[model samples]
Structure formats: C-alpha cells, structure tokens
Target: MEALTGCTRDELIGAPFKNYFTDPERAETSIKLVLSEKKVTNYELTARARDGRETVVSYNATTFYDRDRRLQGVFAAARDVTESKRVEEEIRTLNAELTSANKELEAFSYSVSHDLRAPLRSIDGFSQAFLDDFGSTVPEEGRENLERVRRATQRMGQLIDDMLLLSRVTRREMHMQETDISALAADVTGELALDNPQRDVQLTIEPGMAATGDPQLLRIVLVNLLGNAWKFTSRRQHAHVSMGTVRDPEHGPAFFVRDDGVGFDAKYKEKLFVAFQRLHAQEEFPGTGIGLATIQRVIRRHGGDVWAEGEVDRGATFYFTIPDLHVSCPVKGKQP
Candidate 1:
C-alpha cells in the first residue's frame, strides 16, 4: 500500500482500507462483495496518496481463515494502474474523434455527389443543346468553345464520381472471404479488351492466385491497377501486361501488376498514391489521379501496403501485400 499509494507504512498499517480510497462508497461496496464472495479479482478504485495525489489502482483480495475455517481477515494486493487507465481513456477519445471526422467527410462527399453535380449537369446539358440548336448560326470558333465547356464539365463530373468512390472505399464495411484474384484480374482485362477491341495487347494472369479479403473492394483494386496498366500501354506497339503474386520476406504474400507501357520516372513515385497528384500531362495520359489513392486506402484497410517501381519509358510494376493469407508457395524467380 505504501509503494502503490505513496503512503507511509505506519500510516497504512492500521488505517481502514476504504479511508485511503478517493471514493469511499465504491471501496466499501467492493469490500463487502469480497467479504461475501471470499475472493475478488481486479476491483478498481482511486487511491489518495499522503500528499493528496490520486492514482488508479486494482486490488485482488481473498478472505483468510485458520484451521477452524472461520473468517479471520482479508489478504489483498494492489497494483497501480493509473498509466494504463490514462492510455485507455486516450484511445477512446481518439476513436470518438476519428468517427466524428469520418462522418463529416461522408457528408461532404454526399454534397459533392448530388448538390454540386446538379449544376454541372445543367451546364453540360445546355452547352450541348446550344451547339445542336444553333450550330450553323454560331461561328466555328464559338462552337469549339462551347464544346470545350462541355468537356470541362464532363471531366468535373468524373472527378466528383471518383471522389465519392474514394470516400465510400474508406468507410464501407468489409466482408472478408477467400477471393480468386486471378479470376478477378481476368474479368477486368476482358472488360478492357471489349472497350478497346482494335487495340493489340497481350494480358497474362497467373492462375490459382487467391487471398482473403473483401471481394468487392479487392476487385476494385484489381480494376484500378489493371486499368492503369491497360491505359498506359495504349501507345505500345507490342503491349504486354501480367498479373501475379510473389512472396515478400517482410510483408508476406504480395501481388503485382506489370506493364510494358509509358512508365513514369521513378523519382516521382512518391506522388503516385496521393489523391489528385499526377505525374503525366492530361494530354499524354488522361486520368483524374484518384485511382491509386483509392487503391492504397482499400489495401490499407485490408491490412496491406501498396508500392510501385518504374523507369521512364521502360515499364512499371505495382506491388501490394495482404495480411493473414496462407501463401501456398513462393515465386521462383525475381519479380517483374
């Protein structure tokens, strides 16, 4: 009691235990329960020190008896838990604040999706209508300006949609299960091929690659990565894209998507996963620059990390690792 409560041994030797507690009522109730039950574990109270400082403590007590089995007194041990209690309270406060912040973010995303898009839609709609209704009356330069306005509104609409998707990915509840990543990659590739039937591209996906995660969110990851590969490889004469898994010594099982495309400079890799950060000009490679950011958030939510490696005009490979997956075997050679 002296060491735990900062009281002198002589002061605590004959003092009532309840008298040392900050809340005597709670201490009395706990003592009664211990007496009735014969033992009590982890009964918590605030103990006041001799200098008037208070500390949280947990007590374990049991009734002591002699050969006749009649109750004699209580034997107890106290552990100071003030630091642990403080840490727990801090964690609870941080969690509450984070939840409140997420709610506000969701509300803002909702406004962007609905309130902002309505006027953008009207702008684009009227621009198109004006072009259709008075194309001959307007000068060619004026018609081109209207077309530019329509395109800007369309791009803004895409940005809003992507922002909403990013917000949803962050807050959506995950449903974890075994997912066939190879099949998902193949499906996304097939869709890409259908969208650009004239383009010549070769896509290779390693079979039997699987992991444990939310299938929907994981599919979005694959779509964004594979879509990026497909988009960047558009100018390649012999485009080659591959999706596979590898074993990382530090991060466990990792997945990758490689592309022989117009790869970016490695020096700018740090900006790849940041929202609205673009390394390429829109005319060179069109994107809203939110895909990689969204992919990173989804992977992080699944207890994973995403990274990329590339050289200017050489090629690029994106890698991501998912935790808690039972990797069957490691890839034999170096990663692409």
Candidate 2:
C-alpha cells in the first residue's frame, strides 16, 4: 500500500485516506459501503502516488468493531493490477488481429480456387471437342497428346475441388451428436462396391460402434479411409477391409480402418496426413493426395488425433480417437 501511494508511514499515518486516490469521492463511498455491508472485495480504484504516478488497484475492505461491539473503522488493502491489466489488453488485441488474418486468408484461398476451375473446365472441354472433330486427320501421337491434355485438365480440376474442400473443413461449423460409426462405414463401403463392381472386396464392420461428433464430418472420415482402403486393394484378387474400435491405454477409446493391401513404408507414415504428400506413384493410386489431410483436420476439430501404421506390401491401419466424447462400443470378440 505504501509503495503504491509512494508515501512514508509518518507522512501517511495522519493523512486523509481518500485523498491518495484519483477518485476521492468513489474511495470515500467504498469505505462507507464496507461499513454498512460489512465487506467489499475487488473494488477498482486509481491510486495517485506522492509524485503523481497513478496505478490501478483492487481494494478489499471490511468493517472493524471494538470488543464492546461499538463500530470502530474500516480496514482495507489494495493490490496493484496495472501490469496484469496491460497484459490482458494486449492478449485481447492479438486475438482480434489473428481472427481478422484468418478470415482474409480463407477468402483469398476461395477466390483463387474458384478462378482456376473455369480455365480447367474450358481446357478439358476443348480437348475433348478436338479429339472428336479431328480424330482421323491427326496422327496417332497427336491423338494421344490430346488425350493427355484432357486427363491433365481432369486431374487439375479434382485438385482444385479438393483444395476447396480442405478449406471448408476448417471454416465449417460443427454439429455434435451421437453418431453410428458402423452405419456410416456400411454406407461408404456400399458406395465403393457399386463404383467398382468387378473388385472382390470383403468388408467387416463391428456392430453398435458409436461416437459423439458431427455426423456429416464423421461420414466423410469413413468415406476417405474406406475409399483409400478399397483403392489400394484393387490389385488383390480377394481384398479384406475392416472397421472397429479398441481401447488404447494412452488415448482411451479409438476407432480404426484396417486393410490388407499394397501398403506404404512405415518411415513415411507422418507424410501421409500432409496435403499433396504422396508415397506411391500417381499411376499406382489415383488421388489428389488431400484425403488424409482433410481427415486430420476434421478429427482435430472434434478434439481428436489421427495416425497410421503400415508396412511395405503387408497392409495399413488408420486409428483416430475423439477424447471426452464417449467414443466406444462393446466388443464381444475379434471382428470377422
């Protein structure tokens, strides 16, 4: 208190207490309030030091009485909070600046992606038209070159669409609720089967598996994981894919998508979830290399983590956990 007022004990002992504060009227009223109400806490006041330096302080006071029950006076203590207040203001300003920057970045990404799509569509359309109109006149090499142009345009269009989806993953609002993991896996696998009717794929999903999260996002997670599993297992005469949950000692209940397919090196596991990072050749697995990154973003938004375990040519398994969301189901035995 003496440091805050910049006064010696001798100089302050007989001085009027309210005179040391910038607002003498408020300071006097605070003391009267403590007398009537018995106590007051965290009453903000600006204390003017002897040298005219002002400091923001929180005053806590209580009424004191004599042993005979006669009202004596109010005793108060003030703590300097000027530095803390300054830090709080700085934090608020930084948060506002960050929010503004993110909004601008999202807008820029959307505009660029939207602009690129128009030219890509035009290129693909013109290339197809040329092949149809001048197929006999063009040499064999010229026809193949036109086909390559169309393919490149198609791939570029997919990449642009994926980039936009990735951006939306961060910007979209989440609606959390109880979602059935098994049902979502079933739906995705059914679509995969219809798309690749020739492939013989065996899919097993554990029953009654559920979690609390955005149903739409969770379905996307299944689509990407199961779709990758289905794609990579294309070479196998008989492919096996499974989905289930297991209790991880560190992460609690965890969900997984496992497949017996042409897997990747374990060393490149970290690269799998990074956008545009590919382990296999584009010819071997056709993708925009953005699926795993999208899955990571969606899982993280729900306070979860996603990881992969794989070995060359053996298989791969992806595990994700949503902590604090009651993600679990009763496993009777091993899933067939």
Candidate 3:
C-alpha cells in the first residue's frame, strides 16, 4: 500500500495521522480542535503529489479495535477538487462586483434626495407667507381652510427636510481628521444652552480628549447624543450629562454620552437606531426619529458602530466610535 499510494503505510499502521501533513506542535493543536469540534473524522485537505503537484484529497479515517477491545490500524481514501476551486474563484469575483454596484446605488440615491430639498422648502415657505398675509381678505371659513393648508404644507416640508438629511448622510464623504471630542460636546452644549436658556442643567465634558473622525459628522453625532440627553432629562430635578471615551479593541476608541433622563428598556436598543423608528410618544418627546438612524450611518461610514444601554425612567448611555481619521479611503465611484 505504501508503494502504491506514496504513503508510509508502516508509519500509518497504528499511530495518529497528525504526524503527516501538520508539524508536531501544529498537530497537537489540530487534534485538540478536532476533539473540541466532536465531529466525525472525515475531511478534505490538500497534499503534494510525488511530482510536487498540489492535489485536493478527501479522506475518512477513524479509530478501530479488535473483538478484545484492543486498538487496530486505520484506513484512508481521497478525492481531488481542483476544478471546484476554479469555479469558486469565478463566483467570488461576480459577488464582489455586485456588492460594489449596490454601494454605489445607495450613495447616488442619497445625493438625489439632498438636491431636491431646496425646491420643496421654497414651495412650502411661499405658500405659508401668502396664506398668512392675505387670510384676512378671504372669507371666514375659507380663511380657516387656507390656514389648515398652510400648516399641512409646513409639516410635509419638515418631513421632507428630515428625509433629505437622512439621504445626504449616506452619500456624504466623511472627512477624517484629528477631532476634539470634548470640544464638539462643549460646543453642542453651548448651542443647546442658547436654544433653551431658561433650562439650567449641569453638563460635564472631559477636556483634553480627542478622536479621529470627520468633524462635521462628529457634530451630527454629538448633537444627537447630547441633544437626546438634554431633552430626555429636561424635567429632572437636577439634570446631569457627561461625555467621555473608553478603550475598545475592534473599534480603537469609543466615545459615549451619559445622562440621567427617562431611560428605556434595553430590549429595544436595536430599534432605536433604525430610520424613522421611535420608542417614545410624540407628545413626550418631539422628534423626527431620524437622529439615531443618521448616527448609525455616520459611525458605520467611519468604520465604527453605535449601541445604547438604559432602563425605564433610569437613563441611557449611548456609545459610538469614530475610526482613525488619518487613514484615506479611495474615491471609488458610487451609483445613485
């Protein structure tokens, strides 16, 4: 058998097959893996022929014993898969092209939405101005109808704005650079302060910390995280908000926004990041529900991620990452 199959049949007669293809140290590790897998001892592998050519082989080898329960020799067989491998490479190339096309389409659709927003805003604005200025001259019930029309137009306009923003997020090119996370937080806090000067809230931002990410996108991320923190904790006795970063292996570094606000169940964390998805009633919290969805897109574009943790009436901590900005991505053309 050894002479026919080029195998040292004497060596294979009793000992384990590990002494063959893989080295001693590797064989021990491989054997442990096999034991842990608890699968049948049948697998396909590659080996070098006597002519030094590579051949794919399949073998079924197992433990054996005599009627006395004593160990016995193992037998093996094999098959080749060189043609199968050639077909697999062709399929992989096709799949890669398909993925590239899909990514291009997503980017294009986003740009188209952004470009259409300006015209929609003008139409809504002019209709409102005309209704408000000339309502007095119109008939009583007719004027009321015009006011309703104006309000409806404004609401639709806001919805369009949100949709456009969400689309632009997907298309926009992220400009990665050294970004001051604390400064972005502080700036957003200040803006929130100016927006709601009457609300006295204690906001703490850890200074001297930074992240590598696009400044503009980071602003959007900070605005959503901090703004949610501010709004949800608005009615608290003494509102508190904190911003800081934590170490991560896969994402490098992660920044988080913490607040003592009306938190939610952890079960719905995934839903919170989806577009147009909201967990709270509109009356409790006024929002387009596009914020977190946009945040998810931004983090992903930077090769990062976002997640949240909270309890009902306790508070929520939102964690997000910004990839190292120094790295450059090729401007591969994307579709609309």
Estimate the TM-score for candidate 3: 0.57
Sorted by TM-score (best first), the order is 1, 2, 3
Mind giving the per-residue lDDT tens digits that candidate 2 earns over 1-336?
688789998889988889999999999999888988999999999999989999999989898899998889878888889999889989999999988988997888878787888998899998888888988899999999989998899999889888888888887789989888888889989999999999999889888788889998888899999999999988999999998887666666788899999999999999999999989899888999999999999999999999998898998999899864443456323423
**Per-structure clash totals for the candidates:** 0, 0, 2
Which numbered prediction scores highest in TM-score against the true structure?
Answer: 1
Candidate 1, residues 126-235, lDDT tens digits: the string is 99999899988999999999999998999999998898899899989999999988888889999999998988898899887888999999999998999999889989
lDDT of 3 at 120: 62
Ranking by lDDT: 1, 2, 3
**RMSD of candidate 2 to the true fold?**
3.0
How far is 81's C-alpha from truth in model 1 (Å)? 2.3
Q: How accurate locally, in lDDT, is each candidate? A: 0.89, 0.88, 0.72
- Give per-residue lDDT, candidate 3, residue 158: 68
Model 3: CA > 4 A from native? 1-152, 247-253, 323-336
Q: Between candidates 2 and 3, name the one with more favorable TM-score.
A: 2
Question: What TM-score does each of the candidates earn?
Answer: 0.86, 0.85, 0.57
Query: Model 3 scores what on Cα lDDT?
Result: 0.72
lDDT of 2 at 283: 89
